[model samples]
Target: MTASSSIGTGPGRALIAVYGLFSLAAGARATVQIAGRFQEAPLAYSLSAFAALVYIVLTVALWRGARGLALVALGIELAGVLVIGTASLLDPAAFPDETVWSAYGKGYLFIPLVLPVVGLYWLLRRRR
Candidate 1:
């Protein structure tokens, strides 16, 4: 019921940690891929970096207890996963390599697709 408790207690911590890991993983992968072979699949690489940014924003917002910002970031993440996943599945030419959302996060054990859902649910449950 209090302010900080909503963000500091319960499942929030687990969610925050997971998001943090995802941020690092995606960000590092994007940076390496973009720097190494950006020309190979510019769109896919760019999308990878964008997904990393979304994960970072969501992680920070949640850590700072910014409910609205977290929600918005998670919304973007979910949309990105859906759209990119669908596109990658339907057409492989545009994304020769793989972004975080490729195949609905098939490469990442589908965590990319599920994370946003969990994040959104956590935000909603914490919201009064």
Candidate 2:
């Protein structure tokens, strides 16, 4: 298959796998936080849930080779990481607990910060 047509094959498969994993991770974390201790940090748990939704959509978009949808999802993911990361750092009191995006995803080894950049590059590179 030509490289351009292989957006969901080869390396792109790995990207989709990562996105899928992140979706599950963030979703589970959010579920537990919201059910068990949401009173401790409602904003943090809600952001985790939002991040999970973005990752879910991104995984599907990448797997389906939907470039436009992937681009929009990646844009949202990157912006969330940046804004939430900064907010978490600037106002630690506001985030008594951590979200998937806290401290630029330090909890996830910075994958949340890096994934959108990589996904964007992958999608753009495959553009005609």
Candidate 3:
């Protein structure tokens, strides 16, 4: 892809950076939580690790200008946040500890909730 059409350029650079940051943050958080106290909240820790994996894939997709893959990953990310956020609120007992997507990423200032929307917008906008 040309530089002009590359998702890693211009505004997409910020998106990629945010995704990379989330990958690291979520991965590290999950590793620590899982290794230290998996029994405390297996679901929550596993979900955090899953979110980290999604972020890693999304970041790579954006960097490589793989719009289709990025779109799919973003959709999954958004759905995960929404579903997990609602589940955590409605049934707190299910999540003894918090995941990266807990409460729509409240701990991370809701960036997890909004990032995919912004990414979808950026990718779609770049297409035209």
Candidate 4:
């Protein structure tokens, strides 16, 4: 096959794989939080669902090679992580409980923090 197609086979496949994992993980966590005990912490649970949606969108956009959607999702993910991370750090009381972006995704081995950076790079590379 061609070089571009090869990319879609190797690194591209890898990227999509990571995105898939995040989608599954975030989606499940959000589902549990929102369905199980959302009343205890609506803000945190809602944020979890939001984060899950973002991950799902990001995964789909990347797999479909929809550059615009991918860019939008990645940008929003970056913004969410930064804003939430800072907020959790500065005002823990405001959070009440941890969402995926809490402490910039420290709970997820900081992949939540790093994924957007890598996604942005991938999207930019695809643009060229």
Candidate 5:
């Protein structure tokens, strides 16, 4: 078996890399936003922090081959991006600034929109 087969059977190294990118990006963004000017956009910054937490959890779960936790985190992340994406688009005023999911992650090149789909696919494939 390959190194990937030694873990859960899915996308393997590629998925880990993607998850790592998200973990780093989200964590850094949240850390800066929450630390710098949280008072300016409390809700948005808080949501950013939450998104970072989810990303971190998702990354670790995937790395450890915890398919169940990965699925749960990815599902929650998908729902969050969708709901917040729509809300941000429909009600710009509701958000004083941007969150991780704002505008469907337009600021993040829509990766927020795409990552969950990939994650779900990997998770389902591993389930079989």
Candidate 6:
């Protein structure tokens, strides 16, 4: 397939690459946090693991050129970040730690908040 016609090629490749990196980061972080001290904050730890799973699904969807799946995953990611961010801010005691979306990914430099917007725009602009 030509580069322009495939989401996994060209610029989309960069997006996917970032997504892959995030998948690994979130997965490893969640694993360590959950395994070591899940009892400390079950909700936050579970959200971390869930965020990792979403990143994995989003990365796979983009790589495979599954537009619908990518859209859904990205949407969920956006909502997750917003909801989690707000909840954490409103109730600091509940979080007590960080999930990928906590504080809208302030811990990760807000990339998680922005990635989904870019991914959604890329997918929608592809004319697929």
Report every candidate's CA lDDT. Answer: 0.88, 0.92, 0.93, 0.82, 0.82, 0.91
**In terms of TM-score, which candidate is stronger, 2 or 5?**
2
The better candidate by lDDT, 2 or 4, is 2
lDDT of 2: 0.92
- Give candidate 4 regions above 4 Å deviation: 1-9
User: lDDT by residue for model 6 over 8-116, one digit each (tens)?
Assistant: 7777899889999999999999999999999999999999999999999988987888877888999999999999999999999999899999999999999999999
Clash count list over all predictions: 0, 0, 0, 0, 0, 0
Q: Give the candidate number with the greatest TM-score.
A: 3
Query: RMSD in angstroms, all models?
Result: 1.3, 1.6, 1.4, 2.3, 2.5, 1.8
Write out the backbone clash pairs for model 2. none
Q: lDDT tens digits, residues 2-56, model 5?
A: 3324344446667777778877888898889889998888888888888988988
Candidate 4's displacement at residue 29, Å, is: 0.9
Looking at candidate 2, the ten consecutive residues that score lowest on lDDT are 1-10
Error of 6 at 35 (Å): 0.6
In model 3, what are the clashing residue pairs, if there are any? Answer: none
Q: Which window of ten consecutive residues has the lowest lDDT sum in model 1? A: 1-10
Question: In terms of lDDT, which candidate is strongest?
Answer: 3
Q: TM-scores across all candidates?
A: 0.94, 0.94, 0.96, 0.90, 0.89, 0.94
C-alpha lDDT of residue 43 in model 3: 95
In model 2, what is the error at residue 23, expressed in angstroms?
0.6
In model 1, what is the error at residue 4, expressed in angstroms? Answer: 6.6
**Candidate 4 lDDT, 1-128, residue by residue in tens:** 43333333556677788888988888898889889888888888788889989988877776766777777898999999999999999999888888999899988999999999987886577556
